[model samples]
Target: MDILSDLWLGAQTAFSVWNLLYCLLGVFLGTAIGVLPGLGPTATIAMLLPVTFGLPPETALIMLAGIFYGAQYGGSTTAILVNLPGESSSVVTALDGYQMARNGQAGTALATAAIGSFAAGTVATVLIAFFAPALSAVALTFGPHEYFSLMVLGLVASIVLASGSLLHAVGMVLFGLILGLIGTDINSGEMRFTFGRFELADGISFVIVAMGVFGLGEILSNLENEQGRSVTLSKVTGLMPTRADLKRMVAPVTRGTLIGSVLGILPGGGAMLASFAAYALEKKSSKTPERFGKGAIEGVAAPEAANNAGAQTSFIPMLTLGIPSNPVMALMIGALIMQGIQPGPSVIEEQPVLFWGLIVSMWVGNLMLLVLNLPLIGLWVKMISIPYGFLFPAIVAFCAIGVYSLNNATFDIWLMAGFGFAGYLLRKLDCEPAPLLLGFVLGPMLEEHLRRSMLVSRGDATTFFTRPISAILLLLAVLLIVSILAPAVRQKREEAFTDED
Candidate 1:
């Protein structure tokens, strides 16, 4: 009963004409960015973040959250129509979705992806509304020691979750951690890795690294690939799924929603991991696994569902725990901190309207995505015909502009370009960038908590293992390392793991 009243209060706050307009604007812009290849939510949000400075904090957060999830809905449109995934999480959609497109079932693929995403997003939003308070309570008990250990567990989970060689994933994480350590030390005011450069004092900008790796790197990769014209079918076909397709999708959607909603709460579990894990789970559960890559509807349905669910639920940790599970959430954290709102248990107690209004707005934004996307599929498909030369240069421009906007520094622009070249080389070498991004985001927070715990314990590192929660978390991290290194476990892991799908 109390929950209902609070939700009503939230709706009242979110229902204002101005707030509604911003919600629509956010979803509209999000869908646009999602349709265009290489402009992901992170890049789009980073670029627009400065503009939100004038809005009230609640309104800004509501709009930003809408854009974040709306990208998940729009990313699949590009994947199915052009075999170009706008977001990493949409990569699996390319496998079966493009196959369906090649076979002239593009309309069906697009429709199903949209519907599945809507369904998953709706369910996850409802779950978040009810579960967030309870989850925040669990998070409130965590001290610096516990938070530090949780981050360690998160890093381990990320390494395990990353597709590719375990050693390579660890190496990427370590590199990210090292990169994160480049700025002035928090405890001691001395710079560690500045190397006599004044610009290095502020550390590597997250926007620069994200834009360079995701936005610029994607542009370069797309430019390298020869353009292929859309293969149209001779006859028009139905867009709606058949009875058999619906039956298969039902189970996958249900399982995916459940899996994604749960995993998305954990640090490092976002849309990309949700999609990957969903594909793996679906494969494991399928009676005929051979159908997975060859126009399998379940392949399209599951990951789309999972990624959307994960996208919605990924807000949980950021909003409730003040811990960002991914780069996108990290940016959200920065936004909230800028607003002078400390995101954690007290956020809800102090600002219930903001909290619940954001949840209610998610449902509204998702409905908008479904209605807006279905009729616009043809338009989005037409966008794929735009020439790469015309398209990629714009992306490059945005990357440069966004990086420079961080500090309005041309040096940062040069730094971004340097990283772009480095990212291009790394991509060529088959090394992944996502884990590195994760490590970079987590490393500073991990260090902060570690130092705080040590100070409380008078410089005893053993304090990490002395606290119960921290002890358990550290043990789990150690166990994960040992399991990955065990010869027999290594063989099984190698067989089970596949490259980014």
Candidate 2:
């Protein structure tokens, strides 16, 4: 079928009453939670996965996708109003957004963010509809050797792009790979890391780990600074930007959308990186670079647009190549698995309703967010004032309930608590949880592909290098590792010279 026909069918499905309701509900919940500091779409979706068990696959997926991008809109609200970024992607937004709020332009900043996000999301959705099929066709040619090499490149890129010490990130990835080994081995049927527990034979639940690490752990971390959260609730004035403001923002938003659209398609690149890159680009290209971080409208508009665009396009790899670009996409992969669907090239061909419906729903969800956030701006402003004393307990309660609901097992709850403590410790050590989650998500696939490749090559280790695609991918992986270490090496050399001087 042609793309137009497929999209038409998708529109029919996405516009159905039930699907529309799910879309609305997802955006509503997403925006609400995103306005709250210390909560993000990852934790929110992880905590709510159990609720979707009874839902149809398309409905559940639509809602989940809604939360992912809807949070982009809501995150900027908190960033502007409270100077607290609700998600990592909003960190750049808070720089100029809070400054705008301090200058009594909170309403303008919020409106700019809302409008820029809407524009970026609309364009990104169209890009997905156009490019996903072509990408899927390319992905169909991948063999086991190529798949394994691609995964290797992805993992290395994730580690290199992640913030903090390279050593620490590597350690976290290894730890996650170890954790992913805690189940029966598919080849030998041997219990690898179950520790003599039958309940663990199937493997550790992704939801439990995600909720503990991101949801509960974030709550604990927030509690540490809860007493010091002094939000500056600047009164919002002027709900619309001036003509000059629009004129200034137009170029930045467009540039940001383009940058985000490209980066979002790369392995291990997502909203966080896209926002940072867009903000940097804006600052570098600005005639008045000194005006940045001091309420520059471009600062707010660029990152906001980039983040939303990145969020939308990041779905492409997961849908078309079965390769998750980030932790959130990994969670979506898990969700697809739960629905008895394997994510890959064939998904679009075999499940056109699911594919097209999700694409159309993203556009619908973006509209819902635009409508929902603009009218409810005042409500979100008040929500920022909610005390952590009242908030953390409710979050803890919801997390516990969600974990238990996964299997009606108290053991899972205990397991979640254990991981929560581990997560806190990891945070204290300044280790990023995102890479760990990605590693954990890809571990099984990595192992599967490795085994298949090895078997096909009759244990010949040269197979990865013999195949052109696999060789190129492995070369890229090596280059990424070298590039990451080169910076640190250069820094050390500079320090040594300074010491000698």
Among these predictions, the greatest TM-score belongs to 2
RMSD of each: 3.3, 3.1
lDDT for 477 in candidate 1 is 89
Q: Best by lDDT, which number?
A: 2
How well does candidate 1 score on lDDT at residue 391?
73
- For model 1, the stretches where C-alpha displacement exceeds 4 angstroms are 82-84, 94-106, 226-249, 276-296, 350-353, 492-501
Number of clashing residue pairs in every model? 0, 0
* lDDT of candidate 2 at residue 491, scale 0 to 100: 73
Model 2 lDDT at residue 391: 80
In model 2, the Cα lDDT at residue 153 comes to 88
In model 2, the runs with Cα more than 4 Å from the true position are 227-235, 488-501
Ten-residue region with minimum lDDT total, candidate 1: 228-237
**How does candidate 2 score on lDDT?**
0.88
lDDT of each: 0.80, 0.88
